[model samples]
Target: MKKKIWVNIAFQVGALVLALLSTTLLLLAAGAPPFQAYAAILKGAFGSAGSLETLLITWSPLLLTTAGVLITFSAGLWNIGVEGQMAMGAIFTTWMLRLLQETSLPPALTIVLGILAGIVGGALWAGLAGALKTFGGVNEIFGGLGLNFVSTALTIYLVFGPWKRPGVGSMSGTEPFDRSLWLPTLPDTELSLWSLTLSLLALVIIIVLLRGTHFGLRLKAVGKNPKSAFLMGVPTWQYSMLAFLLCGALVGLAGAIQVTGVYHRLLPNISSGYGFLGLLVSMLVNYQAVWVAPVAFFFAAVNVGSIQLQLMYKLDSSFSGVMQSLLVLLVLLGEGARQRFLRKH
Candidate 1:
């Protein structure tokens, strides 16, 4: 077991090195100094207190989304509709805030209610996909993809129609929520400590649930071999749906945070591809609960850091996407090679 752990660590490090080298070559080919670009990246992500705060803000949603993805992956379920779920969450959060903007309720309580609504919204969307897979005999991947399109269309319609900024029906999204609806940020920074704390709390709960609970063990059994697990009396379907529920809720929380704590409004592409990025993080960490946060933070840093590359070297921010894709590819290849080597030995 220790040998396997060491091997995994070594492979992860090797993958990072290879990814950096590849990114460096790409930078050189683009006629930019690789080292200087890298330096700028670090500077953008961590040079100032404000930049560090931005890094933490980015890390918050990533931690939530990746942790949620880990849950579904552990259940052998591919929840490809996380993007839709997140969108739904944002929509619901915005709706709640808009509806109660003039209410007499305390702002804190109103915010809590809005967050809950977001979670419900996300769960409903995820549940629809899960139902299609479990009962309608549709593959989750296809069902999820379809739902994602529907969600996107729905959001666009709302933004352009009823929720459109007064008489200016642009895709910019609904008018910003009342300032009272906004989540409290850290002093002198746009970073919300509430969101960060919530993310950390969620991580702890997820780790504990997945590693130390009977339900978790059952889910693992179902994932490993559903037929065998069923023979052993595990209700595979129920557990799978439960995973979807919990995962959706977590992702929804992230969306709610993004709305209230970050963007402060519903917008087109509010998810910002974080759902898909979370999928990659889950894959890179092999869906291990313990590794999810660190990997997520690293990816978030890469994202936040890429801005400097864009500004300093006139490089496209998509370069970060390229780096991320390369890293995932290399990590997957390394995992396969390790498995092959172990089998041979």
Candidate 2:
């Protein structure tokens, strides 16, 4: 058992080293000084108070998204529709705020209702995908992809049509809400303690629920073999739907944070690709809940720091994406190689 553990660690470390080596070569090929670029990324992420603040701001939504995906993953679902779910969440939040902002309701109540609406919106969207998979015999991946496009279209229509700004429609999104409706934040920064606290709380809850609960065990069983789990009396379809709904709820909360805590209004790309990025984070962590926070934070830091790559080295920020992809790919490959090696020995 100890030997097996050591082998696992060795493989993981080898994967990390290969990922870094590949990234370094790519930087050299692009004529960027690899060491300087690395230093700049580190500095941009944590060099000062403001950079740290921005990193934390980026980390919050990522935490939520990653947490949401972890649930779906545990239930053996891809849930590619998470991006759409997030957009629908923002749309619903915006809709609810607009509905109540003119009422005599207190601003605090309005914000809470908006966030709740966002959660419902995300669940409704995920329910649609689950319905398609369960009853329509469509695969979740294709159903989710279709729903994602529809969600994008919906956002565009609202932004450019009904929710258009005062004079004309634009991609700038609808008019901003009053500051009273915005989530409370640290004095001068965009970082909201409420969002941070909620995200961390969500992460903690998910970790506990997945690691300690009978429900999590059954869910994983269903994921591993639906037929066997059903034979064992697990309500398979219900569990699948529940997973989708729960994932959607967390994702929707992320969208709510984006509106009330960050952007202060809806945007066409309000999901900011975090849904998809969360998928990468999940994959990198091998669907382990405990690793989600640190991996998501690292990804967030890379995203926040990549801005300096463009400014200081004239490199496209897509370098960060490349590095992320390589790391995930190499790690997966390394895991595969390790399994083959163990089998051979």
lDDT of 2 by residue, 140-188 (tens): 8999999999999999999999988999989999899999999998898
Error of 1 at 196 (Å): 0.7
Q: What is candidate 1's lDDT per residue for 1-345, written digit by digit as tens?
A: 898899888987998899899999999999999999988888898888888898999999889888888888988989999999999898899889888888899999999999999899888888888889889998889998999899899888888888899888776778888778889986778988999999989988999998999988998898889999999999989888888888889988988998999988889888888999999999998888898888888888889999999988889999889999899999999888878887796
After TM-score superposition, what is the CA distance of residue 11 in candidate 1 from its true location, in Å?
Answer: 2.8
Clashing pairs in 1: none
**How does candidate 2 score on lDDT?**
0.93
Per-candidate Cα lDDT values, in order, are: 0.89, 0.93
Poorly placed runs, candidate 2 (over 4 Å): none
* Candidate 2 clash pair list: none
Question: After best superposition, candidate 1 residue 104: deviation in angstroms?
Answer: 2.0
